[model samples]
Target: MKTPFALAAMTALLLPAALPARSAADPVFTAAAMRAHVEFLADDLLQGRDTGSEGHEIAARYVASQFDGLGLKPAGDAGGWLQRIAFQQTERTNIPAVLTLTGPAGDKSWTHGTDVIVGLNPDEPKVDLSAPLVFVGYGIENARMGLNDYAGLDVKGKIVVTLRGYPKGLPSEEGAHLSATKAKVAEAHGAVGMLSVATLQSMKARPWARMLTFANEPDFTWVDTDGQAHVDAPGIRAAASVNEPVVAALFAGAPQSIAAIRKQADKPGGKPRGFALKGSARIQVESVGKRVASPNVVGILPGSDPVLQREYVVLSAHLDHIGISEAKPDDKPDTDRINNGALDNAAGIATLLEVARAMALSPEKPRRSIIFLASTGEEKGLLGADYFARHPAVPVRQIVGNVDLDMPLLLYPFTDVIAFGANHSTLGPIVANAVAPMTIKLSPDPMPQEGIFVRSDHYMFVKQGVPAVFLATGFANGGEKAWGDFLGGAYHHPGDDMNQKIDWNAGARFAEANYRITRALADSDAAPLWYQADFFGDTFAPNAKKAAH
Candidate 1:
């Protein structure tokens, strides 16, 4: 007997044929067209379209040309198709950045990549610090939740060591924000430096090797109007992720062991207490900074309704990917060297283009304008999207919602999609309504532990109070295993190129689902709204209208 999921998969598999055929009036999103876009963007000639690279510029122009050909109006910086984002790229110098510990036992120096990974401070050419260490639990301080990890602990002029995650009970969004901005919190608490240690679960999810793979990759910050990179609140002089072993070593003379702390942090409602460690840390950092310009391609489709046309819905996909690997396999010289981010993002951009084309060529226009944004610097901490969100081509308040197309792993006959950030706003029901006609299942996030909601380009919009959802192929019809295999093998590798197998039909279906969602948002009488009393709404956009039933 086939399971319910299997039956759903079968039903979905039969959908393409059973659905009405596309006519000249309604443009069909074809796999061949999407593949064409992907092939060009992910070509080796584009050198993986790294942010601020020449290949990236070429890809930006190509997207602009496609948007122009589709008859979409240019909506970017200074009445152009490209929004230039200023970035300050910083790299760590070869000069050995060191972390030394001093205790009753003796002084010991830990290796950079092995026992610790230090983040380069671009503002400071060198950071030399020697301060007492304080264990600050998960390093989260949320006043809304009445949770302050720094409470009862004074870290002034001290090096605060903390775990990576927040308590399990806090809302995912709240916890994610706290965890992400812990560095700033530490700075506010008058800490001179910070040392982060991963829990067992975090280590297993992202191994140290994977974390160190891009150690040399340049870190970027959006440049301010004064032509200066935005700086954090003053106080933190140095920060690094210390190895678990190093963490255990730091607690050598303490009453509680590092293992005990990890055990407590893993439990529900668990709050590890902060304590002063016997040891003090000395950290040294050296950095080199350079500036570059990256362009985000933008195009706008006007709406039929004059009033609704003033409101805009955004469709976004990142155009950048990790470029060529610095470390090449000497034995496999014949192998491809470029990290052609096919599914990582080229597929996403292709999907965006197809959707834009469909909307532009349709006989009926949406009620609200749709903005297609192909962003850059997503690989560099979502910088492009951040800049756009901060300085939008359209009035920021007029932006209604965002539908982000990132890596939709279309390796199998997917029957469902995982829409990150769907639950927070009316966009959830909108997405359900959009996909109901197509008979596609909408799944909750399968791997919430990875924090998929806040990691992508859509997050920038979300931060600015715009409701957003990022669609990805979900765990159905062997998609779980296929997605895992892709991540384990080809993700960010040279193998993520055209050589990998692709299910064109799946790609087409993915695009179709996104187009429907975008159309629904654009045509809806009421704009997308945050759920009343939602954490994100209360925190980011308290004045946002409540969703209409």
Candidate 2:
């Protein structure tokens, strides 16, 4: 609610009035420095820095070296930089997935490639499904929208095939059936299996967005399911309704056409419905599973005040990228094979390094400990962070705030930084107040649709009731359109390489700005907190909402 100037004035009141200004000659962050780090991390030699790979291992060492050079103390478990994790990487292959339909005539078996393709469910061994396939409309259940696609049928142990995306154009609050939340709905309905059809557009463009899930890797989680989760088989592929002819043939005499089914799913009063298709399926998969290890590099700077030093302020950045993709049908060059991830997170990690260096050299350490956390497996699902929060090096209760940096370079030079999940917590004010002096305007989270808040490693901390923030540059800020162009084209693609053109000076200034804000929090007496309105604010105090006035 306060102006940036008012916040700066308050900050000035907290610190010495005569604090000396940083010298112009002081080394600032530069793109050259960031590019230098990216060169190796995103280099062809790193082989896309795949988790548990030798290349990612090299990257870990490099980041650790930077932390070491900054004189940061090892703050990991057992006082080691690496907190080792275990995982299994599985690759399935050569399994028979057959389907057959028995009608008034005889039984006709469906071929694997033509009728359907099978994938394993996280549950291992084998998952054999022979139940009738039900078209559960869009599989949406919304009270407000009056849409319930699963109202009648008992789908337990059955495979529910549905479409992707929400209704074409409807007020979101009206409960237009959303395809995004179907996985949870499927699980809740006791449905053992789910098959999501590509959107009509995606079906027309590409058959399906073929997914390559990681097997449990030593460094990251391969299977993206709850450990307690059960799958009838090791894996399952919910088949896609890609080809129109395929849909037509499958639903030959069904109650509703595929389009009509999707339409009904979008309307109010859409209830659990069923249709019969004359087809049977057989599924099989053989996979290669391996074990590997990855690390979340951490370095700590203890605070000046003994009592407050026990409390911690964490600064984090993910250090991994989307390693390599399975070779696609349209082959390009060797260079196109790797995803450099220069802007996605290499820039973020580089900025964190600079922030740590600056903070370590500050005139005085703040009241709380400052932790430099280089998180791994962010590309996967923030696995390193999840492990860290569960098995903390320090007490989770002692962590006051977590400031996470994702992609900060591409959108710099804007009027302000986009502070995501601001409405969710009290830390928003602290972040806003801290960065005021840098003329860095902090505003509410911009791209909530992207679920940016939930997507980052910071969410792991937030879930634990630790106040957290994820900072990114914004296109809405006063930078060139190229900034947005860069963010869009190279976010997670192979073309995100470090070349000649980049604004290194702006990056340096941005790093400096982040350093100052971190210092402010580190030195402050009051701990950062989540506002009562935040979804995770109640984590620390289960009754926080009820207690709110």
Candidate 3:
């Protein structure tokens, strides 16, 4: 929270009647409004709103029109409401992927889709190998942590099958999770292809739901490490690993138990052993890739005062989801397709839209320009937000603050709104003062380890020296299990629908709270400052004006 320099200035200058009386304890979040907006955005008519698709274009136009109706001006090039982003939508083509293994008994072949699942690998999909299969344990190569799965192994261009996650007894005190990191290390070691043996439930063939909406774009190209282009390779089929007793094998001495192998792999003498199988192994796969375009929508409600108007405040929310999912046994009866990202972001968008409307209705305009951004491709690695941060529509340095609205399924009784990056700026006091009347708790960041502060669209602003705030309903709901259940299950999957039960009144109340805060900041006279020790302070330090040139 930035210091209340603007609030103080406003109080000093305004006559009592001239200023809008701060409403007393108005609930800003409303379940009804949230549901209405979500129902519109996530309805079957939207078709999951995949990026760069016709449905996505419809969504963008609708949102832009809404902003225009709220009296917000175009913040994009040529005074357009949409911030057009050039994106490469890719689709996979028919690519041959084959795996063959020669063992004592004979040779075996595995077809794609049936044998393995693959991450996006570049073109030149042919991966032919006859190398020995070595169990690289957990596939991690972190020497600084005293764990190196690739130790004492020559895995160059060979098949390196390993377990996911880090080695046992490895401390997680650091932010490092070895799963994704280890995969990169394996790739660096010249492993032609990597495989993670499923230990939890053996593989079950996951039902193919519709591909994520973003996957539909034809401009989407699949790339490998070598940057070669390839079409869709077969997807890895989910299957269960079984012991020889569950299968008739050609009489082998291979390790039959996953537990035994895991235990052995942890031992000091358990260097990954390369082995020749008594029988051959075979793999086959089939898949497709397409390319498309999506954008991060931006509009500015410029401030009234000339000097102060140079500074900006930002409000943002992601407008994308995991696209639609295919039906599974766990799917609900009414809705069998489309992962309607209701609470995931449709609700957040509603909050954003409502705030913009309320601001426009207020008699007094904000001192600093207010930027309302609706970003696309958040589910696809935060690409839209990332691009905006790199190429901002406004001068990035002129932006003083950001507020990102993420999740709000239910409001608690006397619940506190947790603000991530609470210590990063002086805006804390201002936020507190605005919400204090309503008795809303203005708590410090709740889960820094979850990295929520750095996960959303506001994160892109924060990275660019802008003090940003991300607010969400309490995960615990004043320590209730029901809220936790809603978070764990419906967060990103298909079940996050509109009729999932929500406190609409609470939502409206919270929305009102946000409205007051945004207005207060906008009507203020001074720029919000980064906290003294905050990371962004150095970039906008008081003395850096001379050096900025």
Candidate 4:
């Protein structure tokens, strides 16, 4: 394959030059200014701004400097612009060479990488357990939905085996979020451990070899004020994802064969019934972890109105990337190995900084204070944002709204934008009004299957009852091809550097739109409220007030 630079250079030459010309370049949010920031943040020296790495700290400091230059007040930890957060990094040190299953027929063994892929627990460094198995269809427990996979089964002190993914009929947004909580459901159901058997569908989507590669990657979780890792339910001792062969072995002599369960799950609206498996699986995992600290650079532009000043409107963008490349070795030594994350988030941070500059320079200040937050560890499961939500710099209740900037595709002159979670709250109209001046259409999510609503830093604040929206350039005017090409070629790879066909004007417009949104939220008579009966709002803030649609 050609080098990333070579490919990007070629793509740049193919891009059309029919973009609309700016009437008068905005002083605050200019393409030149945007380019300057992106050039530095996505520079080769920063290495990819991985969480808790020196590269990330340097990136955090750069954002802090930008915040400082904007004359904003420090809104992070204790009078400083950077919120130093502690994290616990976990990596599997050892895995059992051969995992064995004991059944009524005989003992069967399979090696680790071939039949199963297991993850290490941060809370438990060393764990060895053998317990009776219970196959609980999807292992979901949502009392609100009246769906409890553990209803009839008594899985106490047993290893619960569950099929991967949630029920197929649910909406993609909710389905994705629900699938993420299955592990916690097992823990809540008093299971000693959880094993998820890969479905035929899941394997086809993501092959077993890919699963094995990611299984060895390090896992990180923020350390709370109580010195506890804020990820994974503590009740479960070990967890593993197994292939079809291993799953068949566990289901031997059961009421339903593995094939039957697979077929039932494949059928529309067919819920697989749970039953106790006539086998006991044994698992052992040894993990090593250490405490490290990263910074979430934050600053505030205080409001003029005393009453509204007490309330806050937050503007956030993640400052970290996927770190370095993990590509295979080849004879081509000229291949660029650093994942620069130019569009993945360096561009987003730059957009946020420009917005801060614009907001700070406005003679007419906002009624409510606006916090400019450049978060760390966003690529690592939104850890920094989650930490800030649980342990906030300001009063959590006083924070009114959040606008998170994350990976806005700045390649094309986007005529539309996708505001994720816009429909869920009053922020919808606000976002629409904010972008209307530029004649930019507020487009619906074209790729809801990506589950972007719950995947970004803003979702953490939403979980804390803050009405939030994530903005991105929509798939319009050849944006679909750009997005497809970038995601396939440059995303998270060495190719996401400053050499790509980055439209700086689009970056500026994105910043301008966000600045308007933040200002409007800050100056609004009332804070953004959840639409009545919204899932996230109802789940996170049950008793909070809601807005009529």
Return the top candidate by TM-score: 1
lDDT of each: 0.87, 0.65, 0.61, 0.85
Please identify model 3 stretches exceeding 4 Å from their true place: 1-36, 86-115, 122-287, 327-335, 411-414, 421-434, 443-454, 462-465, 476-479, 488-495, 516-549
* Top of the candidates by lDDT: 1
Worst lDDT window (10 residues) for model 3? Answer: 233-242
User: Per-residue lDDT tens digits of candidate 3, residues 1-549?
Assistant: 665998978877777878767564333445576657777887767766766666677778878988888888888656798776655443345674454555654565443334433334323223333445555666766555556777677766555666544443443212233453555676677665555564332222112122223232333332332433323222222111222222223124565445566565555434343332244334333334344556667888888888888888888888776666666687668865777777777778888888887777667677788989888877765667767776777778787788888766553543667677656676666677778877777876554334465566676676577766777665444624645677667766667776676666766766777787787777776566676534344543443221111
Q: Which candidate order results from sorting by TM-score in descending order?
A: 1, 4, 2, 3
User: TM-score of each candidate?
Assistant: 0.94, 0.77, 0.65, 0.92
In order, how many clashes per candidate? Answer: 0, 37, 76, 0
lDDT (Cα, 0-100) at 347 in candidate 3: 75
| Model 2 stretches with alpha carbons more than 4 Å out | 1-35, 95-118, 134-153, 162-185, 198-257, 264-283, 324-336, 444-446, 477-480, 538-541, 544-549
* lDDT, model 4, position 313: 89
Question: Sorted on lDDT, highest at the top, how do the candidates line up?
Answer: 1, 4, 2, 3
Stretches of model 1 off by over 4 angstroms after superposition: 1-24, 169-171, 232-234
Better of 1 and 2 by TM-score: 1
Worst 10 residues of 1 by lDDT: 326-335
Candidate 2: worst 10 consecutive residues by lDDT?
211-220
